[model samples]
Target: MQAIAERSPLLSKYETFERGLPSHPESIKHLRRQGKDSFEANGLPTTRQEEWRKTNVAAIGRTSFERVSQDTNSLSHEQIRSFLLPDCIDLVFINGRFSHKHSQLEDLPKDIFAGSLANALVQKPELVEAHLGQYADLGHPFVALNSAFIEDGAFIHVPSGVTVEKTIHVLFLATARDGTPTVSYPRNLFVAEESSQVTVVESYGGFRDDRYFTCPVTEIVGLANSVIDHYRLGQESLGAFHVATQKVYLSRDANFFTHSINHGGALVRNDIQALLDAEGIHCTLNGLYLARGSQHVDHQMRVDHAKPNCHSYELFKGILEDRARAVFNGRIYVHQDAQKTDAKQSNRNLLLSKGALVYSNPQLEIFADDVRCTHGSTTGHLDDEAIFYLRSRGIGEEAARSLLTYSFAGEVLDEIRLEAVRKEFEEFLFTRLPKGDIVRQAV
Candidate 1:
């Protein structure tokens, strides 16, 4: 076939995906039908859509990007050498397709299930059908599009009363091949049944500076008495565009901790929705993003309380530099029937340059008068006094700025439960940080 084809009224991108999809002819047909219906219903989320009023994906929709290239990835061999953890279950994907060669999975507890979404479809259709697309509505064009055309996605099932001994890491690499504008929609579905515990880590990889598009959709189901810890790292090509949406459903006494760190990408927009559908469920949302040099980072989150005695806490902090822009929209919805629900939301930003920008909106729509719900949003620069204090203590100006910058993002490091992963991330994060306003260096 041709390298790239003009927009088609029939098939998306090409006849097939980046790589051949997993074995799921029936599910694929089902998804294609639903996807076409959704696309027809909602062409795309325009500026008119209140949820996307601040950030627009019209540019993505207007262009018919080329399909992913089939060339072998350079990240194959050296990845494990530089890879941080050895005692973890890892799944490696290059150009959006799973590679069996580089992955490592050992000592996983009997209860944890990890594999390609394509594999999950063929092996565990019942699990996939029972909980897919249940929490998030199909209003947004991208999400609906994802649900409609989902070929294969990551699947993790933690059985009841089993705490997985090791963390499962998913690494996705997208590279610029043949100068064609490529795209990857990596999907993930997680199921934590009653009294089960699991942790999932998603790490973004590929080139350092190349223009690409990564649109991913993730679904998480938290059953009764289950605990799940999720860490999503966005360190893609600096010129790439990332649009990801995650919808979570929480049952009775379930606990969830989700942390997102975005340090790369030209335009990044993430939407996370958490639904507390049963009593005594608790979830925490924590995030950090460093935007620089005309980059844009946006985060939209919603914590929904539809049942009684559920609690949710959300905090998002960002650092912007050199004309970078960041936005936060946090909404907590408490239905009238959700009595005694407790929800708290906060968004704070730190602007390091005169041209840097931040837009924040934390909203609470509480239909229950007896519930406790509070939401707040703040935007400001780093504390000058704190920087001055550090400089006064015989610290160089550059070192002081670095200290303050790292400290501004230091809160997120606390929430990471894994010491090895957190330490490695800190090191990488520090190396990528700009010098900032610090002009002097002290011996």
Candidate 2:
């Protein structure tokens, strides 16, 4: 019955959150109260909800986790350089707080306006409050929790008619020290006005703290005729738990593209939502997950077409090996006013071992008569014929399996237009695949 902010049992553990989750003293007060209201109204979701039934969150509540503390004495700068991305402006957030001293903003474009939500609260309170959480459905428990504890977050804005050449990258690296089970709510907001073009890449990581939980939320808004490319890359450490959300808002004549790539984590769930608010919008979503070991990964997506002449295409594929498990829930809702809307969605998964399992559900809810929408999903094992084809070329059986598996996963990787970035991540995925072909011989 009380606010999440007031009754987080994990409080008194992190001094950073004790400061009332910093914000523009006056302007953000109202929004903070609203977040508290939203969170209390809808607590942690349950299996009773269709979207949550497959991906259970009840067990997580049993284990208490503190907010990531600001202790970083054990980590060195040299240790973090290995996680850096190539040729992009970079910002680093350590332990749920922004560290401008360790950031690389020299590479950022001149037209873009970037700042920490903490600073933006004081300097541009009205602007931050106007658009923050404007596109997300706070009815979701995780999103509401993130909003209630609005502490450290990244904010970016690209004005209309501006063409940004370089991609903006944000890295959230949280570490749990002193045996404090922790969680980081890394909130990020991106706004692109009419005709603006930009690319944003976010990588989430953690230091060998599997007991730690990272619940992050990203919200984006795309205006008329705007073109936006975005990516969410998760490379959390071995013992980490990740719960993240990707929300996008599209206006008339706008175009949006998103790719979600997940490599490693103990338990990971990603919620991606896109709201097509206007007509003539083009949106494409491509996601892939290679979860191995005893890992559990879930990807859920919702796309809503509220107006006419909107087109959306979604393709999500996954590879599960060992005892890993995955779940995918993709839903497309076409409103009555959304006529002539062309929407297509597909989810295909490949399991390398019988122990691995995948649960997929692609649903279509159409209320319009003149719309064309189709949805389909399937889960299968590696293709025997494809493996044989590679073996016929003198490749060993084990090598053949690896080759076929990579090719199946490569379709989603190739969707990434950035050559260098894609290549780095491709190599990362190669190491995760079962040893064979290039991986074994190269090692």
Q: Per-model C-alpha lDDT, please?
A: 0.78, 0.80
Q: Which candidate is the best by TM-score?
A: 2
Give me the overall lDDT of model 1. 0.78
In Å, residue 53's CA in model 2 sits off its true spot by 1.1
Candidate 2 per-residue lDDT, tens place, 1-443, comes to 96444444433343345464543565455555576667666667788997788777775666688765455334577867877877877777776677776678886777677757777777777667778877777777887777767777788888899877888888878776677677778788888988999888878887664567788888898999999998888889867888888899999899999888887688899999999999999999989888888888999889999999999999999989889999999999999999999999999999988999999989999999999999899899878887888789787788778877877877888899876568777777576665633753533
As for candidate 2, its clashing pairs are: 210-239, 210-240
TM-score of each: 0.91, 0.93
lDDT of 1 by residue, 1-443 (tens): 64543333323743455245555656455665666577666666777778878777777775556555444345658754464355678887766667677677666666567877767778778777777666656666777666665765578898889888788888777776666667777778889999999888887765767777777888899999999998888887887888889899999999999898888888898999999989999999889988999898989998889999998998888988999989898989999989999898888888889999888989899898789888888888778898899889877666677777777677777778877668776776566654532321321
Candidate 2 residue runs with Cα over 4 Å from true position: 1-27, 72-74, 435-443
Error of 1 at 144 (Å): 1.8
Number of the top candidate by lDDT? Answer: 2
In candidate 2, position 289 carries an lDDT of 88
